[model samples]
Target: MAQDKIVFVYITFPNSEEAQKVGRILLEKRLCGCVNLFTNINSMYWWEGKIEVSQEAVLIVKTRESLYPEVEKEVLKNHSYSCPCIAKIEVSEVTPCFYRWLLQETGVEI
Candidate 1:
């Protein structure tokens, strides 16, 4: 419980291809510990004063809160949307072993 430094970043992409690209970039750059992509989800949102709906892929990125800004920049740089959906959820609870693994993967020593 109380995983203060960990965060789950939620991002929606137009397709699995883009999601994979961005996910790999994040992993390679050590910006995130891991990324899980969920594909073929229907998303509806408002944009430019109109409603839009599409099949989208969502990426749940696990990382430290300290790296959030860089992660956002990386996603924005590779994203195709004029306005992409990027949200971060604080990780309130995590198993100690898994949390340590996350930190180690992201190049943080604990």
Candidate 2:
């Protein structure tokens, strides 16, 4: 895979406020070009040997694959959850214009 390929960092927060907080931090730091937040997402998963369900906010960060480590580190530092869900999804493709825009916004050489 290309090192500079765009990727989406998917994260879940306790609430929209928390999501927005971290999202802004990522943007301000230029770790990500943009973030899309979805609130009131119903999540069900296993936690501590039991099933848990909750309403959470999703923060999808658009950034370069090479910046995943920094983005994950920042998210871990600012996130409230002890074990926050931070997953990186490599984008298969994107529009040329948008890709260039993302690279420019993230300070990547286009």
Candidate 3:
């Protein structure tokens, strides 16, 4: 994917409140154009050399690829987990109108 293309940053939070808090911060800072919150997600993963299971809320941050660092930094600063799940998934395609809107919302020149 192109460096300037948009991406979806997937982040897992302990609960909805924390997810919303961080999502709002990212929006207010214009680090991300939009955020979608998916709460009450069942997650199972390996941590500390053991399998762990928990209920978590997911925050999908829509932002440009170039702004990933800033988005990550802000998330790390506000996240409650010492090792939070922040993964960037590149968007292969997006509608032209939506792309322009996203860029505009994030304060990027279209």
Highest lDDT scorer: 3
TM-score of each: 0.90, 0.91, 0.90
lDDT of 3 at 25: 95
| Candidate 2 segments whose C-alpha is farther than 4 A from its true place | 1-3, 47-50
Error of 1 at 38 (Å): 0.6
RMSD of each: 2.6, 1.9, 2.2
**Alpha-carbon runs more than 4 Å astray in model 1:** 1-4, 47-50
Clashing pairs in 2: none
What range of 10 consecutive residues in model 1 has the weakest lDDT sum? 1-10
Q: What count of clashes does model 3 give?
A: 0
Candidate scoring better on TM-score of 1 and 3: 3
RMSD (Cα, Å) of model 2: 1.9
lDDT per residue for candidate 3 within 45-69, as digits (tens), equals 9879999999999999999999999
In the range 3-110, model 2's lDDT, one tens digit per residue, is 488899899999999999999999999888899999999999988999999899999999989889999999999999888999999899989889889888988775
Ranking by TM-score: 2, 3, 1
